[model samples]
Target chain A: MEFNSRIPIYLQVIDTIKKQLVTGKIPPGNKLPSTRELAVEYNINPNTAARIYKEMELMDICYTKRGLGTFATQSEERVGEMKKDITMEVISQFVNQMEELGYTSDDMVKEIRKRSKR
Target chain B: MKYLQTENLTKKFGSTVAVDGVNVVLEKGKIYGLLGPNGSGKSTFMKMVAGLFHPTSGNMMVQGNKLSILSKGEIAFMPTEAYFYNYMKVRTVGEFHEDFYEDFDTAKYEELIKDMNLDMNMKVSALSSGMAAKLKLAATMARDAKLFMLDEPLNGIDLIARDQIMSAIIKKASEDNIMLLSSHLIDVLENILDEVIFIKEGKIVLSGDAEEIREEKGKSIVDLYKEVFAS
Candidate 1:
């Protein structure tokens, strides 16, 4: 995945995984790749991969089974919440950018609706 | 767990000091990026830790023991320059490393060589600069050392080859060892660094967790490197 150099890499990876989980790319209760595997896959530091798993565990997005491996949360509600969180985040960023360009909320809604029809 | 610690590590060449009273602690289970411009003492500092050059003063401890012959066995160093004989074939080089270091794993060497797409029959002199760099990395990483110090492993390598090299380095990283890579290519190395040490004029100017530094400065490590070294 392409990363923003300005942001922390681990946070970026975490967000990517969250988006995947929300989209069912990583299905509920599915096993996550081992930390080393994640590191290799993303070309990131192994330590950062470990931290990603740890942070996800703490956030209830994933859980680790002793001697098995980490798995995505099976709760549909949690996944649904994550989807909403991501959608809001993207919308807010887009809105902020449009506002910076002097576009009003009405203009944004009108433009978005016009584009949706196309 | 501090795997490697240096206290007032200093090295000098005649009247000029290459590494000035620098104190640093490196822990296991992490990869550290030593970032600096040319002639910033990055190589000098790594050479001292590798035992190729003795510290003019100060003490270095590796895995709780003073830097000595025993510690040397646990440290694998890949210098910036090609150290192999031009006459030697790639296979001979692997055999050579196996003969010298007890930690060198011949099987691992073969695997790495194959992964890097280097032919065993190819002569060292026949390889391109990029291929030579890959060969050096494969040879050095074949050893299961406690500390791996690679001086500019990414230098002279192409983008695709760089990804291969990075994957190899990532595979070698484990909880029981510390990997220290020195490279001025901050953008390339930033993602894989657990911590970053910015060196200037033989001294560490800034050092901290890579992510924390980004969060604190609100800039990328590349930007930070430029800012730190800018006159």
Candidate 2:
């Protein structure tokens, strides 16, 4: 994936892994690639890839087992919460963009309803 | 221990100082990018570090030892241009290194060459530019040296070969080694560099962790390089 130059790369890494999780491409309890493997795949420092895991683990998106590598969290509730959070983030950007385009909340609601009818 | 250190290192060729008063510290386990435009002294500094050229004044230290025979054994440098005898075959070069360097690994060199899909039977003059680049990188990475300096390893390599070469370099890197790669390909190096030192007019113009620099400047390394060297 081509990362944005403006944003920090670790955050972009987190976004990619989270996107994979939410999309079910990497199912819960699945073992993700090791940091070294991630580094090679993305052509990043192994330290940076390790940071990606550390960030995810802090969010409960993934957990590590002693002697074993990291695995995606198996908590359905947490996954559902994450899904909602991602949805809200996208919706926030969309609404903010529409507001800037001279659309009121009511106008957005009507437009959403009309679009939903299709 | 600091993997490599230069104390006001200076190198003068006649009236021109190729590398001037460079002071940098490279620690083990880190991948550093020595970036600059042409004539910025990137290669000159690397050559000094590699012991290919003598400094006119000041000094450098490798593992607390001055630049000497022992330090030469500890540093592996792959210059931009490929240097091989016309009659030398692919495997012959591997054997040459194996005989010359005590740290060279024949098995690893063969494995790398095979992985690179290069024929060991072909003469050095017959291989394509990409193949030769891969061979040079593979040979250097096969060494168990403290530091590896690659000067423009991606100079004429294609996109697919760039990935292959980068992967090889990353594989050889460890917590006990430091790899310093110089390139004008800032975009490609930005992703892999742990630290970056931007040189201009034989001086370090900017030096920092790459991601933090990006966040702070709101610009990519390429953009920063252009801004720094804009003429």
Candidate 3:
């Protein structure tokens, strides 16, 4: 994935993995690659890869088993909540941008209604 | 743990001070980008660490030992210029390193050679500059050393080959060794650098964790590079 240079790369990677997890692209409870493997896959620094796993673990998005490697969180309810959180986050961003463009809430609803019918 | 530490390390070419009192502490399991423009003392700093050039002042310690012959064995230095025999085949280069460094892994060399798409039968002199760069990187990275110092590893290489070289570097990185790569190509090296040291006119001007620098400066390392070197 192309990264925005201004932001911390680990944060971007975390979001990417979170999206993958919520979308079922990386299925729940599935094994995640080792830190070194992830570094190679993303072409990022190995230390940054370790930090990514550490942050994910703290957020409860993933957990590790000694010598068995890290796995995605298996709790379906947690995954559902994460999906809603991400959806709201994205919608807020869109709403803010539309607000700047002089689009009201009714206008946005009408626009979405118009586009979905097509 | 500190793998390499230098205190006021300086190098002088007669009256010209090439490296001026560079003090830095490098730890194991991290990849450091020694970033600077050409003639910014990056090479001089690396050579001193590699034990090729004696420091005019101060000293450096490698794994708690002063820079010595034994430390050279643990350090793998890939110079910018091509340093290969014209008559040697691509395979012979690996064998030559194997004979010189006890830590040289022949199997890893062969795998890197294949991954680099270099023919073993090809003559070293016959390969293009890009191929030679790849050859140099593969040879240096094949060494199972405690410290790996590469000078301008991405110089004179195409885009595709750059990706291959970066992949090779990422594969060689581990928690047991320190990899120091000097490059002016900040954008290409930025993502893979755990820390970045910016050297200018023979002195270190700025140094910090890569991500933390970006977070604090509100700009990428590339932008910071431009800001630092802008005249």
Candidate 4:
């Protein structure tokens, strides 16, 4: 992954996992890559890689199966919640970026609707 | 416990100071980058850690023990120089390491040599600089040491060979071992490093989690390296 220098790396990693979860790229009940494998893939510390799973567990997005491995939550309710969270995240970022460009809320809504209409 | 710790580590040659008052802590399970310009005391610091050169002052601890014979065995130092015998074939170097280091794995060395596409029958002196580096890295990494210090492993390696060497390093890395690599190739090494230590005049000017440093500075490692070395 091409990491952004702006955000914390773990956040970037979380976002990627959340993206996959919401999009069903990694469907429910799927096992995540082992912590060691994840570390190698991202070229990060194993401790940092473990943090990724810990955060995911705290968010109820995945659960550990003892010796088996960590698997994505099979609950549809949590998946729905994750989808809403992702949507809100994108919306806030868009709004904040528009605000940076000196565009007001009304201007943003108008432009967004105009663009969606076409 | 710190995997490696140096308190006021200093090294001098006669009246000239090569390393001075460098204090740094390293932990296992992390890949660290040792960054500095030439003559910034990077090599001197590494040599001190490797036990190749005695420190003029200060103390260093490896695995909770002071620098001693025990620590030396667990620390694999790949020096910048191509030290292989001129008549020794590439495979002969692996044999030499196997006999010298108790932890050296001849099988892994053979695997690495093949993966590196090195001709085992070729004489050491006939190999190119890049191949020689790969051989050095392969030999050093084949050992299951507690610490692996690679000094300029990718110095003159081409792009493709750099990738191969990097993958091998990543594969060899585990939660039980620490790899400290020195390189001027910040862009290539940054992504793989867990932490980055920037040295200037033998002191650590900046060091932190690689990604954390980027977030804190709002610049890539390459940019940070340039900004630190500049001026």
Candidate 5:
């Protein structure tokens, strides 16, 4: 529940749920934690947690039912769709950062592979 | 929506310019820390925004509308010093707020009042510093305002009471509200602040995402204050 300062919190919340999905900590159709619970766990304002949930709903990553909590929305097939979206975005950021650090794509790939092996 | 904004806001006291040329934009549904040393113009700036003091120049806006004498109800400003009529009981303070703020949540006030274990019959003058502070906080949080400005909210409360007050404050933040708190206790607010605005010598010296400032500035906010305000 630790929050990062550099990025917007809503985006982080989205990424956290996405990570949970990929890691199998939370599966499709599983109920997400309540906003108050998340707020207390993270020591964040409840409003921020609510905003995160609202944004996730907008992205089709989650949905809410009246009188029920929010749930992960991506089906097993759509899981791959989410993965592609996240992977491309993450890769773009990594590539840009590596370029700024004077590393080529081959070097970046080599370093990432080395890291993965560890 | 940006719940609050200040345009070239300046406040003067006699010959001294306590606040000068401050421009601020605070979006709704977030918490902001206003950090400054004593006499750095933080209180003065907030006072102007709260309509407690008139700005010598510039303007303050709440929810995209300029704050005027007519628009005071949208803001709830809690001053550092607690004041109430000496003869009045604690319950009277709650009742007063209920009468004043149109959005006052009476049920919430009663619940918080019960949680504090405050005696409704206790007179304001008879209560100790910590008790008075708690009462003030309870009343302030009970209001359903668009913006909440708390100045030095933790000043005199003990550590245990401090935690309770913090939880109370956290509970108050909802999707419809924003909170601006000024405190000298950097470590207490270390993890709570979404963003921090640092003031020095009546001007904004630094302001940004709190964690980014900590990581990039190579120091905690306390250290930054010491360095920036160091003689």
Candidate 6:
């Protein structure tokens, strides 16, 4: 994940891991990118990455097995959780775009159906 | 009336001054981008305005009223870190917002939830970082406060998501409202902000109308930022 100099770096770490989890790039029970590895990958302060992981662990997005590296928390219901969390922010954007394009609910549904076909 | 104003605001951590002598005025119905380098005091400055950290010296007033005295119901602060009950479902967060913020619009929140294609039943703890950031944005934007202070609103999320976040903020902002957004993404904010305020070493380095700053600086706001915040 590329870190923007403006936003706090810990946030970038959180965003990156979130994407990995949602895309199944890091499935449940999967060992996460080590704090050191994440720090190196983003070229950020290691302390910052550790802080992000610690926050995620608190959020129950990941768990530490002790003596072993941190692993993705096993939750069959997580995909729904993530979708709801992301959709709230994304929906407003979608509504704004539809407003810009002058698309009504019917038009939006049709567009979605059309997109789904292919 | 000025939507948000800070009077001689000063914030210090231990002996370190994160913000010093900051007297800023953000007018109603305008978006102000608080720009600065890392640890240059952008977040601290925002925190002070949000009343997260009491100004060690000085004061912040929203709509000419001191924010310190006003209840949390009046001002909505979206910190860079997502603040939600991880154990709660997404729908429950909406209830929490409604309960805390007097101006929170539950209908708007629910509509946004559906529009975003999110499952209201999902637990917050199961969300990814991007999801958390987005959720934070939604929760904050759902409020009908006089002032909205967003610290690094687009700090996370993909380029597409960044555009979405920006669009949401723009759509939600109004003449009766003030949106103070701090982000390192100068390019994204350059066109959106009606005014620009730059901070360096805990002081207001430069601030003025965005267009005037562009005209006076003789460069895009991004270029000016690069020059001002040059490492």
* Best candidate according to TM-score: 3
Model 3, A74-112: lDDT tens per residue?
998888988999999999999999999999999999998
- Candidate 6 has a TM-score of 0.64
Residue runs of model 1 more than 4 Å from their true location after superposition: A96-107
Off by over 4 Å in 3: A114-118
**Per-residue lDDT for B64 in model 6?**
65
Question: lDDT by residue for model 6 over A39-74, one digit each (tens)?
Answer: 545544344556778999888888888779889878
Clashing pairs in 3: none
Better of 2 and 5 by TM-score: 2
lDDT of 1 by residue, B50-109 (tens): 887889999998777798898889999999999999999999999999999999998999
Give candidate 5's root-mean-square deviation (CA, Å): 7.2
CAPRI classification of candidate 5: incorrect
**Ten residues in sequence with the least summed lDDT for candidate 3 chain B:** B62-71
Which of 1 and 4 is ahead in lDDT?
1
Q: Per-residue CA lDDT of candidate 3, range B171-213, in tens?
A: 8999899999999999889999999999999999999998889
lDDT of 5 by residue, A50-106 (tens): 877898888777899988988888487666687887889888998999999999888
What tier of docking accuracy does candidate 4 attain? Answer: acceptable
Among all windows of 10 consecutive residues in model 5 chain B, the one with the lowest summed lDDT is B62-71
Q: List ranges where model 4 is wrong by over 4 Å.
A: A91-118, B114-128, B208-222
Alpha-carbon RMSD to native, per candidate: 2.0, 1.9, 1.5, 3.4, 7.2, 20.5
Q: What TM-score does structure 2 among the candidates reach?
A: 0.95
Chain B TM-score of candidate 1 stands at 0.98
Taking chain A of candidate 6, what TM-score results? Answer: 0.79
- Residue A116 local lDDT, model 4: 98
lDDT of each: 0.93, 0.89, 0.93, 0.87, 0.80, 0.77
How well does chain A score by TM in each candidate?
0.91, 0.88, 0.93, 0.82, 0.79, 0.79
Model 1, CA-based lDDT = 0.93
